[model samples]
Target: MKILVVDDDPMVLEVLKHSLAHSGYDDVTVAQSAVEASQIIAKANPAFECFLLDMSMPEIEGDDLCYWVRQLPQYASTPILMVTALANKRDIDRAFAAGASDYITKPIDMSDFGMRIQQIDRKNSQNAFKAPASISLLDKQDQEPDRIDFSKPVHLGEITGEVDLASLENYLLQLSRKGIEGLSAFAFTIADAAKFHFVCTTEEYLDILKSTGQIISDHLAASGFFLSYAGSGSFVGVGQNANLHHDEWEKTERSIQEALAKVAVPSSLGLPSKIQVFSGVPLRLNGKYAERSLDILYRTIVEAEDRCGDTSWAQV
Candidate 1:
């Protein structure tokens, strides 16, 4: 549904955006600061079904944002999901006191993230959850078989200036330095391009992803990647998940758009928002030749650029 993801860290925002996108909720808006987030919310009234906010932010805190949101005449009952690194009871209690509907710790789990979102959706639902299938909120998309090559290193070719390339690089370096076991996910801040961008080998890194999903989600939310989008409102995603075919990948991307469509927002701004999914052939991830992986992603981005063809999200 129409949810606002507020975070200051660009990398975390990307991760959360990706996480939610993966979860099938596509209409996600991100705001780096609470002020910008408020502007979007006021503009899109009676929409923004939920808010995934970071507990800490510059100028405004997540708790304060929750309080402000609760005070909004149209959002008196809106759900606010707090993303926090601290699991202290007092901190959670403070969030609740400020009007948070739920709180997820720094490291968020995919299963837990799904369950929490489902719970929130159920609560917002008019009737009680009848059955698994009856809960239609979950978008219907075929799950792709996990196919990732992890025997070698990954590639990270030329980092785009639009993305937090440095942060990503540092994160990868830390992973290599401390070793994957000791280091956790990396966080970053950059201009809003999309929600998140990640590079990993599926077959070998599946457990790593699952194990770090929670932490990744948490860091993203806590940093502000989970905030609402204050940019043009259009998202361009390019990736090659070796496990998914071109058509299957398109379907998966469509599911995200469909999910975001469910959120009803004010059309006055005419924000032409759409999810464009592109795919290419699979490649090897030698880890050492990380450029190969980046090449796949870069090609996808280039394709998106050609298709975007002066069509801005603001016009939609």
Candidate 2:
């Protein structure tokens, strides 16, 4: 795949170029800064297929550059991995909020970097999602969208702080058990959303998803959190839990429910008048029985979904 690498550091740029070639991705382009990257993008013959951007720069920081790239229709759904510092929690969160697909830490590890690229390539082989040509009609007549893939994660566009599901998983995989010490993961799911999906128009269903995603980011707003909406009417996230008490998650759940209550979701399609949102216990990332980030990530998702024979119900 054609690739673009943006970093102000000359050595880092050369190292990344060599690494990509090692992984058999030789069609790589290099840019020293955001302005240079923009210039290259505007005049390219065949558009670059992927982007590797440093999260920090002297001016026009990486997050801002990511936002600029996402605004372009063609690259909206393309892979844009960030190169970040493991200790910079706030910057990592900003990158995700700005629509970065995934990130690799600085002081790059040569051995593992190739594995990350291979993972991305596998998905591309599966025909990763591409941006739609145009917006869907907003009228009530909007038919329900194509079958809701319970396992697939859809894009929530610019407003929702959405990170790709695979990207989120890759982030977790990159962390060591100790690296996850201060973080926790949670899931937010709409009760009986499948019923709503079948009855609501395409616009309404998407609106439900957009609203759920917005509420997750708005209510659970944190400087170190990143969220992903995995299908089945849910968003799963990992964030800094130092400031959030166990009880705080319950409150956030209630807040989300209260916020969702005001939307007046149309009931004509065999849907409930009011929808309820639920949160499973936040799984502490470094807790006992969670020896690996991937394992703990799924455990949190299961807890949020309350599908492991836990008691949970809609309050509305």
Candidate 3:
């Protein structure tokens, strides 16, 4: 992938370029500042496919630069990875919130950096966001929308503080670094979402998910949570205050189902579709998570979700 890297440090830039070359990424262009990066991007022949931005810059910060790139028409969905040494949760959050696809810490680990780069490159190609003009169910269509892969997590374009799964992992990783106290994770699944996927077109299914995510976001917004659609009917969230309540989940679910009931399912064979949302118990992120892989945390979430009955609530 063609990469444009922006960093103020000269030696750091050389090291990054070397690392990219080690990973077989030869088409790299480096810039000393965000302004220089913009100049390079503006003058490039075949527009750069990916970006590596330094979170800490002299003039314009990487988070602001990321937002600037995201505002451009052609590069909306392009991969933009933040390169930073700081682990302050607020800074990291701002970077992701500003549109960073993912981040790699400074004094970068060659192995982990390579993997992160490859993953974002592959993911960017796989799940492209359309940034819907309206939340209303798919606009009237002459032909049916394409079939959707119910299990593949797509890029939820900034829907109520939504970030990609990779950024979510990084957020968790940063949380672990500073002791995971007062942190908890929760998940909710649309009980019969697969059935909806069968009845709705790809675009229509996405509409349902976006709407569901919006409600969940609004409900969890009070808890200060970052949400992501984990596909397969599951929407997962991480909250800093660790306030996960049974009544709140029920209320959120009811709100989602009530809203969905109004959306007419175009291909439902005239059968009124009913939507139900179920939540699993919240898992506390404590010492165990500090030493364990974030992947296992997600697995624990899946297990917790599996323990969920129609009305049963499980605990960590």
Candidate 4:
């Protein structure tokens, strides 16, 4: 696959290029600035398949460059991985919001980076072989209005790479049946999500959803949480008591906010937009709610949405 690596740092550029070459990607191109990258892209015979961009640069920020790259018709759906030293949630969110497909924080982990590139390569290969019927179906879905029907359960594939609510419900049910306790569930919703549909294409909105899911999953991964899309720009996450404490939950909320802040609506849309999240009170998986865990979770999501008038997060 043809790859493009752009970074102001000479050492980083060299290292990335060498590593990729060693891994058999000999068609890799290197750029020191956004202008250079643009020129290279314009002249390339076959376009680059993937881009690895540094978030911090001299003149044009990597995020801005990413946005510019996304505007190019041929590269709209191509993978752009942000490689940077900004490991904070806000920076990561900005990268994704600017249209990055994935992120890698520096000091670079060559092994992990290699694995991510391989995964992208595999996905591209798979997509190249998609049946015409499948493509047509996806095209049809894209033409439809961007609305989520909460009455019916959405397949896991329809949203981000999170498990379905049914899966989370089944696990909770099993835990209840085994008399295990100390599990808690929380619901999350994206504030003013409908406005996104009005401003962004279906594909862009879906990217926002997937990025939001990834932010939540990364924060809750260490706590052994089960996160699933709860329909209509909402998510449900279940975690143990240790991870559901007031302090931990607060940290998670902050992370979510930082990530969402970068997901902005286009200025051309002529509408003020922001990516605010509303989270409900943690519902302990005990007492009367044990048997109706999924129901309780869904209700909590509704409650959170209702209470998220002008706030980043809602408590209970």
Candidate 5:
């Protein structure tokens, strides 16, 4: 993970480079101006994982530089840190509006700087997010266990990890991040994660699903989306944010058409497959949509066999 330090002051730049090096981050790049920073960013390909920008540069003010960084495809999602002496609320808001992820008021307190770096490093860790505690379900007789509760928050980042082909057990453990309810619109493609049989067997795939379900509730938190699963290949997710009314459903159908046409799935098993997404409003609970707010993603295997055409696979 590379960190780009952008500031016009040569002495400040040198100090930052030296300080960060002392702090054990070796891949630091310094840029004297926003123009130079942009050039470095472009040539750096893959982009820097994080950026620390000095807000007082004349070539491009820090806030403006942040805005430009947000405009670039590679840096749009990258974590950006703004360094400034300005502690005004208005300036902080502007930095956020300009797409800065976090800000540091300068005069560079070494202790605070170290703490901020630690915080960002934690966020960057794949396992930083933790799943919420398990809720107890009551039984039919209201005795021990069996009653279900469906109200809870869903956090996506918790379960995602670096995918590895050599480890199936670890991969499944990582997938515990997703609650069963959130996967209602889910679809996946087998990637042969353990290299089992080159193409995963249905039984083995079912085992993986069953094991993951033990961790969280199955079925989605809400309804109105279709799900498909790919085992061992590539997982795809699709979601619909539409209504059942004729007009809304038609719009959703059109959206699916465009999504299917434009959606690009990765090449797997030497074949090109695309995921399909359909959207619809889940059944109203107290007249409101719930935590499954983001569109669910679906993965595809064969085109015709797994195409999520114009219908809901199962209602929530």
Candidate 6:
């Protein structure tokens, strides 16, 4: 595939080009700025198949450039992956909102990059064979339910084997009362739960959920955190010394993605499964609002879910 990579850092550009080349992507073009990328796009007879953009760039930022590329008729649905060092939730939200298909944080992991590209290729291949009418039909069928039944009780052991939602909330309340430092809550959900349920057997779907919960539990447990299944595919985690550092969060996110990617379903399922993880760190814990820790945690998870579409992550 013809790929265009845009980045201002010479080292990053070289490393990415070398990595892509090593991965057998020979028709790779490098651009130092968005302006240069635009020029390349304008002059090409056959358009680039995919884009790797640096989120932070001179002239036009990657997110803005992604938006601009989507505006072009030829590139509207082309995969545009954001390659950047910005790992915060806000940056991720902006990138996706502005039309990024996927994102990779810097100091790139070439193996992960290859897997992501392969996924995009598989999706594009699947899409290429689909008729427009059928595509429309599937899109309509996948529309989210107007009301989700979050009140449904989930057997905690059947899912993540962690504590129930009420227990998690009580833990958070106790921590708040004791004046915990560096407390952070994280929420995770299976992004393609609707489709998974429609396609896979109940046993298979539950297995996937169990694996997902274990992955999250294992990762958080290393940091001495507590995790719980919050029903409707949502999992919440509370950590006292999460430190709220961007690098730490990025590492955790990468671990989650790696674990999820290993999960295999039938190719007939025709869609990639994904997990959406959101981190909520309260910036203030003073005065009357301090007593409402559970409320804050719930709101943060809700905000994270609202900000992230299917197969994405965000922080609030």
Best by lDDT: 2
Model 1 scores what on Cα lDDT? 0.47
The TM-scores of all predictions, comma-separated, are 0.40, 0.83, 0.79, 0.49, 0.42, 0.44
TM-score ranking from best candidate downward: 2, 3, 4, 6, 5, 1
lDDT score, candidate 4 = 0.68
TM-score: model 4 vs. ground truth: 0.49
Question: What is the Cα root-mean-square deviation between model 3 and the actual structure?
Answer: 5.3
lDDT of 2 by residue, 151-204 (tens): 457766543556778667755554442254577777877777776766776667
The lDDT values for all models are: 0.47, 0.73, 0.72, 0.68, 0.47, 0.64
Report the lDDT of model 2 for residue 46.
83
TM-score of 3: 0.79
List, in order, the clash count of every candidate structure: 45, 1, 0, 0, 32, 0
Q: lDDT per residue, candidate 6, 27-142, as tens digits?
A: 89999999999899889778888999999997789888888987676775677888888866557556765656676777777888888788777767775754321011123466
Task: For candidate 5, give the lDDT of residue 39.
Answer: 89
Arranged by lDDT with the best first, the candidates are 2, 3, 4, 6, 5, 1
State the lDDT of candidate 4 residue by residue for 112-203, as single tens digits: 88988898899678757543110112344457443443333333333323444544564555445445556677877777655654566545
Mark the 10 consecutive residues where model 1 has the least summed lDDT: 221-230
Instruction: Name every residue pair that clashes in candidate 3.
Output: none
Give the deviation of candidate 5 from the true structure as CA RMSD.
16.7
